[model samples]
Target: MTNVERFLNQVRQSSLGMKRLVVVAPHDEATLLAVEHARKELSIDAVLVGEEEKIVAAAELAGVCLMPYDVVATYGDSAAADCAVRLIAEGKGQVLMKGLIDTSILLKALLKKEYDLRTGRLLSHVALLLPPQGHGYYLLTDAGMNISPSLYDKQQIIENAVDIAHALGNDNPNVALLCAKEKAYDKMPATLDAVELQALNLAGDITGCTVSGPLQLDLAVSAQAAMMKGCKDPVAGNVDIFVAPTIEVGNVFGKALKYMGGYVYAGVVVGAKIPVVLVSRADSEQEKLLSIAMACVCTTSIPMEAGRMMPEMESA
Candidate 1:
């Protein structure tokens, strides 16, 4: 089985129990079908938030039996998003999913001060990718959020991605801060940030992961390339988290892996009170289901203060 399938199977066997998943603006056939699969296969209870008529129509179109689910009636996309976020804030749901609505609309509701979902950290997107030839998973961060993050924002982004890795059972993940060249140049800001982040990790300011950086893409994932380049960093070839310097780089790289390399992936928004499943509309039903399962695993396994420090890594 692929790493994603293995992870999904692990989630199913985890016995996390039936957690409620609130989908904002679930008025599309793909969304309905995915939730149906989640309900049946993952044992996840889905609360559909949107116009009742459109939801029912989409369910009918997708041949999904929505009779087992609770449907909340909302007039517009904003209303639906607000209602869904409200449900999550009120403890009625453990996970929030984006469905059919524009991501900005849903995220606006999620970030509202009245909802109280913010955790004093920047919210970033983390994509779990199964390489075409690998037996393990790789996480690419900030692809769908944080267009241009500062150095401090990147730190939080790393922490958020590390938490997801921890949730997936990797206690100490290797993080590679991706840059154009392996050497820090005055003209390149990303390489400088990478050097600083590496220092922070070595000094224990960034905990629970080993950070290596100013590494090109090839060296980050290929031991052969690192060896040929005389690179000696342990994380050079065995990275679990690939931190992109920008959203454009992350997005293009992730899409290339998906479209050209045939890698399967599931994307989620972390660094919040709860994990958010934010799959694209074009994402397949299986991808959406996997995203939900991923969120389920993260919701149950990761603590609110996850990535702050791993118990074993703490110096007593």
Candidate 2:
């Protein structure tokens, strides 16, 4: 069973080569510590983009030396984000990290036409959770992005997550489209969407994953609950990914696992030329570092199944 910490350790020691991680507007202590930690512990080269004076001050406060990194001076948070994205576009940086800048600012810079990071695909967030007492890890998707995804958007979201799962060595991850009921009802849109998603997977319209749908929370994770409810399906007892019907549901579900169920997690944004390490402003330093580790693994040397390259990082 791979826990979050173990996964991070593996990422740090994996034979795959390292890449430069650029931190945009790292003016806060948490962000500074996270970047420095990734640099010293994981051997990741780092570039810091922000007002240089403030970044220096933050580094001093965090007890991290700025001598080892490249510091790009930008006028504002938005400008810092733009500089970082431009660096990534030029292939100088392989991983982008969110720091003190607002997510909207970072995203706007990433989506700019000149940046060439966007591939006409929607960006989605995937959180890898180590449950307090679970046998293995679980994934939750779109918890921080795509407020109310359409069926097509959901398909892309699932594809992005499947890509991540493959990167993490799950060749054929089981996906569960979560809903309130195990059976589709026309009155409930999520249930209807789930059924369609399942059909698409069954017909090979969606590849590289096995998906089942319209599963309640209990049935998705608990074989005992599924047996008690008389649900009979291969996915009933085993689900690797939980595709929440809405941003609200995904957000609450991940938080419940963290705040109540005592889970630790690392989340990253996919569907760009490089994976985005996005940690909340309120996140702890450890959580932010974990996200950096996750991004490193996604961007450095992920060899997907069948000798395929990482589709998301492939040149457009």
Candidate 3:
């Protein structure tokens, strides 16, 4: 089986037992179709929060029957977001999905103090990509959030991505901090940060992964390239996570892989009370379904503290 298929199968076999997925403003056909697929294929219960009339229309457009799902009526996008977040806070759902609502609206409601969803960690986006011909998955992080992450922010980003890697069954993933060169130069800040991050990982400050850095893109992913460059880090040729220096690099890298390399991806926003399935409207239904499954798996594995979800980095 392909790595994506195996990942999906693992999620299906997990003992999560019918997680409830709350979708905000699911007034679009893509969202409705994805939720329907998740409900049928993954055995997930879906709660759709939006205008009932619009949801019914979307269901019809998508050829999805809503008889088996719960539909919560709301007047507008803001109301839908608020209602969905409130449901999750009340433990009515285990996953939050972004649908037709503006991301800003959904995130605003999610960050409200009343919901108590914040764990004081930065929220970062992680995309799990299946290469066209590769045998495993690659995680690309901070693509949709944290535009210009400082060194500390990058550390949290890596920790968040490591949490995802663990959910994917990789207990100790190989992480490569992407840079333009294999050696840190005085003028290149990213390369310098990469060196520092590698040192932190070696010092037992960053846990659960083998970190390597100051590697160019080719060296990070291609064993042949690493060999040609005389690089010796084990992570050089077998990276499970690629940490981008900036959001622009990550965004362009992910889009290139999806648009040009024929890679399928499942994306989620981590460091929240629960995993958030956040995908573009243009993404295929398969992508959305995989994203929901990924979130479900994360909900079961992410650690909790004092009755609240706490990221491993925070508790570290």
Candidate 4:
């Protein structure tokens, strides 16, 4: 089994206590089906927030039963967002989810004062892709958030990925700052920031991970490519997270890997009070189950030391 499946199996064997997940827009068919499976099969507890009739309708369409869980019975996506956030803050749930609702609505609710879930850190989305051909899984960041990030934001972005890597059980994740070019060119801002991130890792400003930078996609994954580039570092060609220069770059590259390479994908919003799962609408039920499993794996690693996500997760 994959590390994710193992985690889900663990969740299956004994929940210790069922963890609560506040699913916003739970009325959506895909969202409801995923939640129901997570609850019944994986030992997760959920509070569904959406229009009551629509939620029930979606469940019926999906051929899944949703009546067992608490339904918040809210109207409209905005109202569902409000209820989901309130559920989290009221200690009714530990995690948040997005459904058919706009991500902005859920994010706005999460960032609100009453929720008290913010850690004063920018929340970024990280996708874990287990591309079928490759043995190593990869971390794709900001695919759902941070449209255009600056150097400072990239630092936080790396921090978020590092945290995720640790949560997934890597002791010290190796991170690569990805750019089109492989070296820091003073004129190219991406390369420059990559160099800066490298410096931070070297100077100990960034901990729990080995940071290397100005690496092209090849150098981030292929050791032969790193050797060909004459790059010398433990992180060369073996990075846990690839920090893309922009969300466009990350999004495009990630989709390329998924569509062209047929990757099994899962994602979670990081730097939040708890892991927030968001699956692709086009993903399969197995993919959605894998996403929830990945979230549970990350959640279980919360008490461990940071930077433990490298090497622990391999393909099924």
Candidate 5:
């Protein structure tokens, strides 16, 4: 099995007794099916929050018996979001999974003063794509959230991706900051931000990853392209992560890779106290369940291990 597959298997074994989660909008078929599979297979449990009647009806239709689970009552989408948020705040649940409700409704509740889960930094949605064509997986970030991000917000976004990289056991994650060009120019502020991030990595401000930026897609993923461009940077090839300049770029990259290139993907919202599985309604049940499993493995990577070998550095 590949590293990620191994990680998922390890996650399934270790995620038992981790925490209680809340799944909002249990009325959705795909969402409920994913919950069912995860519950039957993993160590995770969820408190279903939504219209009680609809939730039960959908559960029954989908062959999910809710008798063993606690179902919370909420009248509508916003109410479901609020109830899930309240459950997390009350220490009844560790994370909130989106379901039938609109993403906007849940964001509204998450941003409220009482939720206590809000960080001052920008909220971004990151997706991980792996497929038969690609030898390893690549990341697409800030896709579903953060429509437009300033350089400052991009820094926080990079931190979020780095956290996941660390969890996956990549000490110096090769970060290709996706952009149109390969060099920094005064006219392009994004390139300047990319250069600044590289400096931050060298100064130890960014601890977990080796970042390269101002790279277009070709050079970042293809070592042949890197050689043709005469780009000697370590991150020019073998990049484990892709940090797009904005949400549009990331969103396009993700969908294109999946639809055009036939990739398998699993996504999670990082920077929370724990990883939040944020698969979309269009996602297959396998994708949703794998996302939860990935998050569980990431949770385990938080601890520091003794005598770990850090990635070797190459002088510029």
Candidate 6:
């Protein structure tokens, strides 16, 4: 699979008339700069919603021209979020991004039943980590949403991450159910959950990806770690997605990678009618721009499941 830089280049080089992005409360410097990069690099049309004066000033600070965008005047973040989501529901925008507003406020507007964005699937966060020394990107899921997802929630999370993998040009992604050890103990619920998820994939209850479970983080990403342990797991070294047992795990690990391990990342909310770019306020401009590119790439096409590896998922 291609790395983050390569994948972003592919998105940049795609045909014009890219997906339209609607940003709520777009008055922040980083957000404005990132969207400006998207506008110039990917040809994404933008709809900026917020206090028009503030948005214009911030865009100027970021050296971004707002002339090409539809800047909607709104009173506050709450109103901006509502207005942006309404525009999306009206087909004026193809993607929604959070900007200079609380994510909860944005999500509240998005989840309103009247908006019709829900597909009856759980919304989860997937972050694409671009390790400074790696050849490809690593995906970490449910990091920003779902505090402690149930087994069923994990299923949907995996499905969402798989969709992202497909968007990144990997038709069949390898998933690693990350755990503390390489074995399941009855007392460890995460280990047990891993076992069941792996079984589901093996039995075809999950489709479109290869799943392996109860693997420690090292083994999941390092071929040498698997070799040192005398393990011959197919997904051990080449896992595309790392399924964190809990939100804390994913969140802390991703931050550690960025702050301590020198990795850049892009995060988005999935399982909506369209992909949602939701980067942190502290994220660098590059991270925010990459998130926009990631969301746009995901708008391409859906991955269809053929005869599943686990044929029984067809009936399940």
Please give each candidate's TM-score. 0.93, 0.91, 0.93, 0.89, 0.87, 0.91
Query: Once superposed on the true structure, which residue ranges of model 6 sit more than 4 Å away at CA?
Result: 1-4, 13-16, 301-316
Per-residue error for 226 in candidate 3, Å, reads 1.7
List ranges where model 3 is wrong by over 4 Å: 304-316
Per-candidate local distance difference test: 0.83, 0.81, 0.84, 0.75, 0.72, 0.82
Model 1 misplaced stretches (Cα beyond 4 Å): 301-316
Question: Which lDDT tens digits does candidate 3 get at residues 1-316?
Answer: 7766777788888765769999998888888888888888898898999999999999999999999989999998899999999999999999999888777778778877788887646778888888877577899987777777889888988998898899778999999999887889979899999999999999999999999998888988889998988888989889999999988899889889999989997788877768888767777877888888889988866554322222222100
Candidate 6 per-residue lDDT over residues 75-113, each given as its tens digit:
988899889999988989888988888877887787777
**Residue by residue across 49-97, what tens digits does model 2's lDDT show?**
9998999899889888889999999998888988999999898998998
- Can you write out model 1's per-residue Cα lDDT over 123-171, one digit (the tens) per residue? 7888888766758889999777777678988998899899888887889
Which regions of candidate 4 fall more than 4 Å away from where they truly are?
A: 1-17, 300-316
Measure candidate 2: CA RMSD: 4.8
* Stretch of 10 with least lDDT, candidate 5: 307-316
Better lDDT candidate (4, 5):
4
> What lDDT tens digits, residue by residue, belong to model 5 across residues 35-85?
888887676778999999999889878888887578999898999999888
Return the candidate ranking by lDDT, descending. Answer: 3, 1, 6, 2, 4, 5
Task: Score candidate 2 by lDDT.
Answer: 0.81
Better of 1 and 5 by lDDT: 1
Clashing residue pairs in candidate 2 are none
lDDT for position 15 in model 3: 62
lDDT of 1 at 289: 81
